[model samples]
Target: MNQFTDKRKGMDHKDLAVEARGLVKVFGDNRAVDGVDLNVRAGSIYGVLGPNGAGKTTTIRMLATLLKADAGSAKIFGYDVAKDAQIVRQLIGVTGQYASVDESLSATENLVIFSRLLGLSRAESKRKAMELLEEFGLTEAARRPLKHFSGGMRRRLDLAASLIAQPPLIFLDEPTTGLDPRTRNQMWDTIRRLVKEGSTVLLTTQYLQEADELADRIAVIDHGRVVAEGTVNDLKESIGTSSLHLSIQNEQSLSKARLIVERVLNVQSAVTAEGGKITAPMADADRVTDLLITLREAGIQLEELSVQKPTLDEVFLSITGQNTASNTQVKKEELA
Candidate 1:
């Protein structure tokens, strides 16, 4: 099968993995994650999606024990994040947005060091290092310094380093952000394999399609609040009715079609002059039939017409009143 086709395999969810209730984190005057609740079933991928500074990274950090929470509670494998942090740490692996692998060390050396730090014996560390190298398709370049690795390879090694102990839960923060398309697919496959092996994952990403493709459930956060949360289809349904798009033969016909559709549907309608198109939220499937008849009776010629469900981006925009693409770009610049 081709690489594109290969990346479309099904994902399996098996068990309850991570749970959070009223997860809150504050840094001085800033409340990064405010009253967020999450439940990541075992062996499933749960995605946390938001614009930059949406508390995604802060949430992950608190969950991973890298930062302490000001209030609320989080548990991993039944261990409390605040009190039983060490145990929680042992049960989860984390890969941050940026590659955290040691650039001065070779892939093999990096893995070995991480394994030893996790308490593996010297010989066992070597074994674990080799195992991860092979699993991440990095065996051929195992001895290469991380500085020499390509962006994708470095990401793989960074992920591999996080998995040296094979923790049951993994936190991936924008794991595919900087990789090329092929490498992004490769990383997605790697995540799928981890889930298949009964690992629960809590992923935070800015890519809408990535979450739509991989997450069993998605939570959209804005301004440190979860603005919306549901399965992809559920979220789409919550946004409102499907949009009916019509292509008219001319600008005059476009205005007529909009008036007809608005009268029939009793809803606000938009007409685009550039494409001579009209769009409106359709409440019923029969609305299309009625709309076509109205347009025909009005002597308007439509070149094309179709209905489409709201995409994740649309849902986000509806809830937050901000465009995700522009927000992401702004965040990138701030990070830079």
Candidate 2:
């Protein structure tokens, strides 16, 4: 076997698909990635979340061996990324924000070419191409040139191309950035399936919902550093386990209601911008009953009330203190 093959053999069956420590990358005076560490468990979905220009892509490039790190080290399936890049490349696949497929080629033709380049037999290439096209719900568009495909269709085809070999680890950088809800959900299902079939998915996204839905564990990156890392529940509980939300029937009672909620719950509460609803973190679920009783006794009639676990949006804001959607969009446009 070749030296690269030998390295691959030795690194096989590792429990961590990706292990990165103190990874730093600098572009001139800009330190795009700084002291970031990540550990992605094999066969699980791990999300890297950040706003635009937050080093998410730069960090992925270093881990994928597309870019060298300025400091620290990383390994893919136990093979060092810098010293064993060729072997590491064989064990991982990457799908970026933009499709990498040939625009002039039909979907079937593109996948067939990728399969052939990966060393499948001619008949096997065609079969794999068709199978993947169908699996991605692109059977009808298989014959259409990619230039005519919609953004969502192109994204799906790009992901399908990456899976032709079913590499053990996949890096997805904002795979659903601009996709419609339906297309985004479809991509989510495919990502889940990749993990179910034994591929480790390390995806970077700006969408809170996407990370919350797909990631078993997440690392929240901000200012080119890992600000927080843990399971979804762990991060949510870091701020508060659950939240109390209520809307009062009387507009004037809103102020009174906020006071009662804070006093009874022993936590600060925020009123919505329109001065209609109040929201507070709930430390003890039992305290919810006390708050409700206090509000009613104080002559505040409730319009709506519910206790819900802190959403990933809340978690991100609490950690980074930024509005993800607004900040990401402004920064993304600036980057472009």
Candidate 3:
């Protein structure tokens, strides 16, 4: 047996809705998805985070059965993705960044059409549509064309359509990419409800905050490989427990203050975008008290002081050296 199989020998594979191993896909000599493995527990949100070109979308497509893996194996609910693609189709729903709701159709019309296509009777489809429209807070706008809906409303409608069958597993590819803060929060609430109702989700996004806020477990991918995998706290602890941050009142003393902090703490300092400020990541909070005394004796003239820790954004910048825009462009199209 392979190492992965051996490691999972005694575990319940059914508890994991997604188990992919050594998944590889290439495009024109570019290895879009390298030897990546994923294990997402059922009924939890598993976030795939990376900058652009990080192979997140490509890997997701493979698991969704929209793209075939060039190598390795993937299973959804113990059904092989390649050998049991038809069954896979029945088990999952996909909602991309762009809402797929028809622009010409009203909210009610869109959901009804999808439900009908999924084989619901006319009356059943209409009933399902109304339920979802109200669940998604589109009841008042049910008769409005998708073109008249705001970005967030359209996305909610898109998600509503994907749920026409209430599949066991769902794939959400950046479901809140360009949404406003309030709308993003609304979408987050919907996703949480899905998990509460017993649906497993595989969400891929470039938004670090969204991942931090939602994912039960997270995997950071870069250059087609996973560089880190763990819960939010686990990843933060890997970087550092917490850090001390302060802002200088006097611009002239910034350089002198920075040097004093580095020499006493023996850790590098990061300058934030806010003028006259510096940050240092440290494990012990007690150290901040000592640093304060030393800086006081030196008369650094500090304006602000606080204790903080590393965030997921720092984790991505620390490891990948890029932002969400660094995602992969080498995707395989079924052009043949």
Candidate 4:
């Protein structure tokens, strides 16, 4: 086997599909990317989340070989990105924040062009284009011009074009930016499908729920550095606590329910009128069952109740002290 093949063969003991250390980049006087380290495993989705100007795009660009990092190193499946960029390119596909398809071309035409560029024969390209168009629910609109396609359809085509060669790794740079809720959900489904088929994906997004829903692990970046990195539960637990939320059937019941919960859990409960919801800190995991039994014995009828860890929005605000409201779904124009 060649040396590159040997290095990959040695990867049987390595858990990471992508690895980087002390990555940095600069644009004129601005340091777009600071020292950043990343380790993403094979066959899983890793999310990088941040607001605009957070260096997410710059980091991904370095990993994808579009831009070189000024310092440190990056590797994909044992291939060094800077040194073996061509080999690394052979293993990865990238879908940027903006749709990469030609606006005047048809969906099938776009995908076929991509497939052909990846070294597929014309006939093979056509077959692969047909398959991807069907997979991404674009078969009916396969022959339709890109201008006629909706924003969502075009986004799917961009994604479809990237997968033309079925590269094992994918870098999705804000894949759902500016998409409607339904269309974003559709894209989420497509991402899950990609992971199910054994693709490792690096996804960057400003949407908090997008990372919470899709990522096996997430790294939150701000001001060009990763402030936090972990699974959803891990990050939530870092600066926040889990809580029990209960809604009483009647407003009058909230008063009684609050007393029952506080007495049973040994914590104060705050009652809110919005949903007749009573919220309390959950210090002990086992007390949830006890609280339920205590409320039942006191004749409290709950309209709704559940235990929840803190949301990603809360974590983001706590870490950066920045208003989550200011983070809009950004386009490529907004990112560095």
Model 1 spans with C-alpha error above 4 angstroms: 1-16, 27-30, 239-310, 318-336
Worst 10 residues of 1 by lDDT: 1-10
Worst 10 residues of 2 by lDDT: 1-10
Q: Which prediction has more favorable TM-score, 1 or 4? A: 1
Residues 265-310, candidate 4: write the lDDT tens digits.
8765665436667777676879889988988898888888787775
lDDT of 2 by residue, 1-336 (tens): 011111122433467899888999877766778899888879899999877778899898899898999999999999999999999988988897778899999999999999999999999999999999999999999999998999999999999999999899999999999999999989999999899999999999986668889998888886678878878766666557777789888898888888888898877676655646787877788988888788778998988888777764555555655444443454432121
Q: Whole-model lDDT, candidate 1?
A: 0.77
Judging by TM-score, tell me the better candidate of 1 and 3. 3
Winner by TM-score: 3
| TM-score list, all predictions | 0.77, 0.77, 0.79, 0.73
Give per-residue CA lDDT, model 3, range 1-336, as digits (tens).
011112345668879999999999988787888988888899999999876677888898899898999999999999999999999989999887667679999999888889988999999999999999999899999998788899889889899888888989999988998899999999999999999999999898876678878998888877688877778666665446666778988888887888888777766676765475687766566667778888899887788887765654456544444433332243343121
lDDT of each: 0.77, 0.82, 0.80, 0.81
Query: How are the candidates ranked when ordered by lDDT, highest leading?
Result: 2, 4, 3, 1
| 316: Cα error in model 3, Å | 2.7
Q: Candidate 1 on 185-289: residue-level lDDT in tens? A: 999998998999988888988877788779988888765677777776666554455777888877665666777888997766665436656766666777678
Better of 1 and 3 by lDDT: 3
In candidate 3, which residue pairs get closer than 3 Å at backbone N, Cα or C atoms, i.e. clash? Answer: 51-327, 52-324, 52-326, 52-327, 52-328, 53-327, 53-328, 54-328
Which candidate's lDDT is highest? 2
